[model samples]
Target: MLSKAFPRRMTVFVLVMLLVEFLDEFTFGVTETAWPFIRNELDLNYAQIGLLIGIPLFLANFIEPIFGLLADTPRRRLVMVGGGIMYGVALLWVASSQSYAMMMLALILLMPASGAFIGTAQASLMDHEPDRHDQNMARWTFAGSVGMVIGPLALGAFLLIGSGWRPLLVLIGGLMMLAAFIVWRLPANAALRSHASDADDAGEPEYGLMDNARLALGALKRPAIWRWLILLQFSDLMLDVLFSYLALYFVDVVGVGEAQAGLAVAVWSSVGLLGDFLLIPLLERIQGLAYLRISVVAELILYPAFLLVDDITLKLVILGIIGLFNAGWYAILSGKLYSALPGQSGIALTLGNVGGLFGSLIPALVGIVASHYGLQAAMWVMLAGPVVLFIGLPWRTDKPIKLEESAAK
Candidate 1:
């Protein structure tokens, strides 16, 4: 039973998980919520502002797989700790920046720092308990939802108190520092230590940076993996496009105030807590990938409904449903991918992040299209994602790659 397996250790794990999620969500929320104020202060336009928002995601996605490969080594802990410290320092830099160029530079540095910790944490979670991948990942997802719920409200409240962007930036940096501290204190589980010692004893070939690239490229060669990648990309694009623009959409298109729209986005995100908690266990009882396919199809059908609806009540309800579908997809899909690449969770998840990174780029294109075409037209373009997913459907369960459990034993 999970209760019997490291009661104290599990508690620490959960706490650290929550801390990481909190820091990640808080950084995103503070940056997003503070955007208008920053734009006004710096006299930046939509294109420049979009670059500021999208650049970190672009860079982070690229670096995550590389970080994931490094996590396979004993040096994972050092990378994680250093990354967390760098992330905190970057946020502090962002908070103190006086000019647009300075803030942009800070954002570029922030991306890799954040990716390091984020990449290592997921790999660590799976490494700590390979058998409990789904349950632990569900918990991780839950923590992320909580962070998403808290972050926007905290930023909004900070802004309301006339604290300006500095306070929000400092708050994120402080949370990241707290996260680094928690991660630093976590004891290396027996499995990880054993893996390290075995590698040292056996004199396994050390993978250099080029070898890491080759491994990632080799994983991508499998067709089933690419199918999963495409599905993940589409889902990520849908989520990013909605999230990146939802505030503006609520204010301009839906005729709501900024505060109310922000609250709505928060509510939209908060509902994900329920989805993660409830959907993961239920889907685990069934086949994970099968459930994911259904959920993805449902999301495709529901997301475009946002374009047709105008009533705030209906829109909120639709958004809530969308959140449910969206949250379930990540929890289920990540679990499925992790299971598929049992020995290579770090590399696989990182590649998945890479797919998400490419997906993140879609919103920038969406924004460009939306500028010329209607927002509805841009959304319609997103609809093609689901259609593609439906067409590129996998026929059978991808066989799980067996790993040496005794190495863990």
Candidate 2:
């Protein structure tokens, strides 16, 4: 579709970047949805589930900056393809794992692998079309949402075929490899598409790694950088972290069975896909910050309602609405972050990874709170996602962003 709309150079770049994000999230949807079965089989408790999710996030975030840095270099194809290969192998390892230790090893490998491939791919997109950050991120998010929607549905189909999560994941692993092959084969452009960074990011290719590290670190001095990065992690509470726990909440808190639980998750992802698809045009019609401000306020009302509701059907309905309202949070926030650090898409990834260091522990913390106080009690922690977003976004939403100017305020 994009190839028809764009020139030859932009066509291949958009397809590859979108494909990478799509498959990356498709696997996440599968892993998260498969949690109940995995928990039952492994006899794991809530905290352990949290540990499994959290520990990998924690470790991966610290390591991901290196990949982000590498992505801004002349050898980006090597970095991107290498990450894709490792990501696929890690998925296969996860499929073959029968024990907690084995799963942990695979997940630890999986997280950094995603940073290398998915995060780097996103960085590539951010580097192109310096003015279209919001519009491009919206397309990127939409692609990911399509993958996310398909993931659980794929799991459901496999379940109907009398196969377990393991087999489904194995197939997804193979699909991931195919995605990597596409990326590897995509034609490179002379316009710094994916193989190299823009001039602002690559001061001198021959400069040592330490020099690049220092330059990325310089992004920290801008207050605008921290604002968006912090909001990104906080936003995940209502976003990915919620997705991580959604299946468990349905099964444990709502008392729905496995099939119903899968349907509930699918409903959330499907509506989210709708929202992301709509956001691309919305970005063109309105300023990104204005849309974010509206979304954040709506999240405050819906998130609490989502927690307090008891009926499974009503909850699913509200869940879809929640997904709808929060749809553009990532696309807009990240777009603004990229806007703030124009031409340094890799630096955006590096800063985002670092900011998420502590936030990665949130899932585990939620699990612990659930274990001690029950899932309902622990669920309140998610409200912080909206609460913080409401406060974190700048008060003045009417104007276009001058992030460098605002960062100092």
Candidate 3:
């Protein structure tokens, strides 16, 4: 029987993980908020700034599978701590950067470290309590929601106190260090260690680079996984594109100041947290594919509303609703993806991250479109992505499968 304390400890671990995510996400938000300042200081153009922002995500996504493969090894905790240290150093480098090229190099190097830590942390949590997978995962998702809320707000508040970006970067670096310490302190499980040793004793074939590639390709070839991946990619694009530029859009296009824009973004993230909270219970009632279909339909309405409305207040309302709906989709889809590939959670998550990387490109592309064409044009282009998601709903083969049944199989 599971101890009552187990849930509490899991919650604490998840919160600690969220703190790490907050720091990681804060770097992006801080950079977004500080970009105008950095641009003026560095004499950078829009294209250069865009590259700086997009490159880290591109690198992180590309390297995630490699990290994922390493995560399946027995030394996950060590990898996580080392990755955290590297990420912290990278952030400090960014804080000290004096040139565009230097900043780019810092971000590219830091991203893989960050990606590794994220994969390790997630794998650790899932492996910690495999029996309580859904509940634990919900807790993890909740923590991420909290982090998303805090990251932008903290950046905005810190910027208000000091104009220079150094203070903000240093603050984030400190948080990352703290996260690394917590990760280091996580108790080792004898059962997990024994399981790994037993598996090794059995002389199971070691998975190499080719094996990893084949597993990823095998995952992609599944029609069910493919459908979910498509939906995930489209939805992620819509969300990432918004986050990457929402602050800028409000500040530059909507004539709002940095503080107000940051607040709006914070509200956007907060509402997403609320959405995830609501989703916890809702998930009990609906299948993963059902949630995906509903979310897609809701987004179709919300996406157009987001673009069509110009009122600042109305825009915030629309963004809040969108955030709430968006929260449910990822968790639910993640559950589905895990179901699609039983007994391979680590690789499944890595493949999902890869899908997310492809999804992230859509927003970067939107940024370029906005730069060349118009902001509204970029927004209009994104509408089609979600619409296509809805169109593909009929093709998905996902249905509710009881956890016990999945485990038995």
- Cα lDDT of model 2 by residue, 20-139, tens digit: 899988988998999999999988999999999999999999899887777656666777888888888999999999899999999999999988888888887876566788899999
In order of appearance, the predictions have TM-scores of 0.87, 0.92, 0.85
* Candidate 2 regions with alpha-carbon error over 4 angstroms: 1-5, 8-10, 190-208, 396-409
Top lDDT: which candidate number? 2
Instruction: Report lDDT per candidate.
Output: 0.70, 0.83, 0.68
Model 3 CA deviation exceeding 4 Å by range: 1-15, 129-135, 190-214, 394-409
Clashing pairs for model 1 are none
- Model 3, residue 139: C-alpha shift (Å): 2.6
Better of 2 and 3 by TM-score: 2
Number of clashing residue pairs, candidate 2: 0
Of 2 and 3, the candidate ranking higher by lDDT: 2
Q: CA lDDT of 357 in candidate 3?
A: 75
Q: Which digits, one per residue and each the tens of the lDDT, describe model 3 over residues 1-409?
A: 3797757555666666656665666576566656666777778755566677677778788877777765555555676788898888888998888899998899888878887776667666665555444555565677677766766666666666775677778777777877887888865542122245534553433455555556666666556777767776776655656677777677777788877887778888788889777777676676556776777788889978987788989988898888877776556555566666554556676787777676656656776777897665666776765686678665455563432344345
lDDT of 1: 0.70
Candidate 1 ranges beyond 4 A from true positions? 1-9, 190-213, 374-376, 393-395, 402-409
TM value for model 3: 0.85
Clashing pairs in 2: none
